[model samples]
Target: MKSSAATDNSSHHVKCDKNNINDDGNNSFIELPPNSRPLEHQIAGHFYDQSKTKYGLLQHSNGDVLKPLLNPPRGPCEEQFYIDVFCQTSKSKYNSEDLINLRKFLPHYLGTYKCQKMSYIILENIIQPFKHPCITDIKIGRITYDKEANEEKIHRMSKNSVVAEIGFQLSGWKIYRSKYYEYHDKRCVRSLNKTDILHGIAYFYGAPIHLRLDVIELVINKLNELQDYMKQQHTFVLISSSLMVVYEGDDNDQELNKSTFVDVRLIDFAHVFPQTNSNQSDENFLFGLANYIDYMKQLLDKNYVYVPIDKFEHDNKTDTKIYSCYKQLLT
Candidate 1:
């Protein structure tokens, strides 16, 4: 119910309009999470409200992703609901960076609603129309510290963990937070979990074999743009951020030489904090993003016969900048 002052930005200013929200707007807020089956319809309805200038999403007093609604559009686009189990840790108000600093979006945020006991944000579904959509979470970030200590902690937890069959990845990292055995199936709705708040899981959409290079360019360019925007906001994405891509299984026309088109969005904002440790934040995302860029290059090199960088070229400066960043991470 409180709105904090927007952080000073060199290139932009962010503010919330008093007319865009009503403190007593809980009339539309549900008390449960969005996975309780019975409230699915209720939670899904928030995305369709067009009466307001910006859509309302539920949030709490502490800036967590639930129990309160955050309004104010970043651009001329529709407002989006930014919710999840994680809340802002430093201040009393929600970190406006959760939505403002983002360079990509799942879709326009509508408002907030809950299913059963958990709260959920309703927004335009990015993958509803894509066919046979399969999303994989790639936990990306530089492995600077000896992962041995982190891995050991994970090992100890596994020894005392519940024997749930549906959780845990091969590397023992927990990624089952929001897996739908079938993405398009309605029966797979579940509560958001700890991984949603912790892991920087980037969901890469499977693209046709031919267009992999184009897609990788799209991903890289977006990250570069994001880094610039984050710096302007005087905020840095210090934590792990994700890249979610949604694509189709449409015909890979052997004759149509063009790269296949895809829709991609970045998710997860738990580690995105204020600009206190800007240097480290830059290190985390630059190296982390560079690492992902290399991964894609390797995948395309081995699987495809052609690699065309011009499909999404910027300029010589960009190529040098990106390549140089890649070299830094590798060396």
Candidate 2:
């Protein structure tokens, strides 16, 4: 189990246990659980093609034969970079009795990704799913580290000095990767794009209409719960990009109900503040809130709220009720 003292000061800690790791020596991998639908690998061969001249084909996960074109050599001319994919993991088994008690107290930390592509790939590939009009064919290359350079980068990041630079990295990655998919299914809602607001409004107004209201409510409730949890720890929540709250419908009956379990996800923390930074002040909180408001306004101005639906009749009033509830909360 990897633990961090810094997380103790945060409102909540995310712990990733041994179960999360499929470790073989220094190479650690986490295999996402099999969903009812196939878990697609969006990057696949695309990663191999980037900077083909450098970072020669190291090795594939499957010992399959590598074609010459697939083999790229790593060289100085190649734009090498690193990314940290941080997540909380547990040290004990899933059913271990210790987890029952320790789970409540575990803290979450940022996952690091060491990758070669520009930082924007992080947003397009990782953050886009949570937003509207989901993107695809985005590949994140391998992770590596330049000890001296990373040390400097980390020092700057901790002081909130490199925020603008980080933002630039995110934006650049987004534009470069946008070529793969110009547009996605309107219903998917990729991120906080204009289409997302429209979809959110449609989901709210079209209610009494069957949709995933519970999932949205679950997410809101979880955020509230996380907020309270963080308060107890004397930490504040920061909105880096957008958060995702998910609920899985019953496959057996194909019905969505409160009984369905909920999963809340916080995405794109490029702007999140670490509790380790003692320099943060109340002003930071206000700034974060202002940013959040700006985002919320974008959603509302795009008709994210369902104004027409309140006029209709429906059995499940929960959608409108919850939307109204969050409207006030967000404002």
Q: How do the predictions measure up, each by TM-score?
A: 0.42, 0.32
> What lDDT does model 2 reach?
0.28
Candidate 2 deviant stretches above 4 angstroms: 1-209, 232-242, 249-260, 267-331
RMSD of each: 16.8, 16.2
Deviation from native of the Cα of residue 132 in model 2, angstroms: 17
Any runs in candidate 1 off by more than 4 Å, and if so which?
A: 1-107, 143-211, 227-233, 236-240, 253-260, 278-281, 299-331
What's the lDDT for all of these models? 0.35, 0.28
lDDT tens per residue, model 2, 190-283 = 2224323333333432222344444445444555554444333322223323333333323223343434355443333223322443344323
- How well is each residue in 255-297 modelled by candidate 1, as lDDT tens digits? 5323434555554443443456534445555555554554455
Give the distance in Å from residue 73's predicted Cα in candidate 1 to where it truly belongs: 25
Best by TM-score: 1
Best candidate per lDDT, number?
1
